[model samples]
Target: MKIHIIGGGNLGSAIAVGLAKNAKGNNITVTRRNIGFIQHLTEYGIVVSQSNTEGISEADLIILAVKPHQVDAVMAEILPHITNKIIASVLSGITLEYLNKKVDGTNTVLRLMPNIAAQFGASATCISARTADLPKANVVTELFNKIGTAVIIDEKLMDAGTVLGACGTAFALRYIRASMQAGIEIGFDAKTALAIAAQTALGATEMLLNQQVHPEQLIDKVTTPQGCTIAGLNEMEHQGFSSSLIKGIKVSLQNIKSE
Candidate 1:
């Protein structure tokens, strides 16, 4: 499979790396106005990082990974060479209709929102393709499945998905930092506290997958009535962890909508 990717930024590079590592005979070209990511794409082919001005070769898919503001310009740049191929866009705020208007012979349009875990092939991505593009949607699903979990969502809901999974990394990290701080305050060294806290978080996440237990149920197991864990839980609850997280996600979602 051959893919031409525009905007070789973090998310773009991440998806490319994921595909190149897992797929056989995969040819990927990360194209953008600049070559900031050219050095990284060299192992695959030097041609991709070069200017895509001459037009890209026939590709199974063409990806637009440029910033939201650059969407129009990038689409215009690729307009002449554009083919009737699948175009998967990972840019935020740019809708399908805008893209359809910008490029011709390109009915196969898809919008994706994937988090940063993609670098480790562990991202959570949501995809939505047009009706004409539905036939080829699974190909994208399968490709992203190599990187992380992929779910099909309505395009209307993609902005929310961005706030949910795309920005969720920092939310998880905040908990990790809190846990590490708690460990340190109790007497563990910085490194030991961080290791234990991070591993514990990892273990808790794995438990959610491996054991299929609800978070509250897991908390139940950890906190015996009148125990130290319960005391900590009570204090955290008093401090409004649930309220804070809910408000944070709500505010973030609103911010995405506003943007």
Candidate 2:
């Protein structure tokens, strides 16, 4: 696949690196206003372009990784060159209807929500597109799956998925940071604390994935009657840990909706 990612910002660069690492005979091009910032990507045999039109002209898939506010200008720049190529956007809050309208319905559009973890090939990406574009959408799903898990969902749920899967990455990291802080308070070195916290989180996630069990089921197994785990869990609840996370997610969704 010849993939052109417009906007070599954090997300765009991460996706480029991830795809390059996978090396599936894909020719990847990434663009940025300041090309110097992403020039290193060329070391991985990824092309770096400063021209959106030039990049889009030679690609089979055009990924819009630009900011939501930049979409209009970007679409204008590439609209004349766009053909039947698959257009997948990683821009949050940009609806399919908006994209279609901007391009004058010249392309098949798919909205993707993937986090920073894609750089490490562990992103949980969500995808959505019009029903008529399912075949192209599946191609995108497969492309993202190379970096991590990708699920097709209803377009209406894309914003919710962005909060839970995209912003959720930061939420998970914050919890890991908290665990490390607690470890430090209890006498572990910073490095050891970080490793323990990260590995424990990874193990918990793997268990859920492998067992296909509910999180509460695993919580039950860890929380013995009158145990320290139960005590800590209860304390976290008392401190509104879960409530804070839920509220945070809701706020993120509202922000997207308002945008």
Top candidate, metric TM-score: 2
Question: What's the lDDT for all of these models?
Answer: 0.81, 0.91
Model 2 RMSD vs true structure: 1.5
Candidate 1 overall lDDT versus native = 0.81
- Model 2, stretches more than 4 Å misplaced? none
lDDT of 2 by residue, 63-150 (tens): 8999889998988888899788888999988999998887776778889999888888888999999999999999999999999899
Candidate 1 — which residues are off by over 4 angstroms?
43-48, 53-55
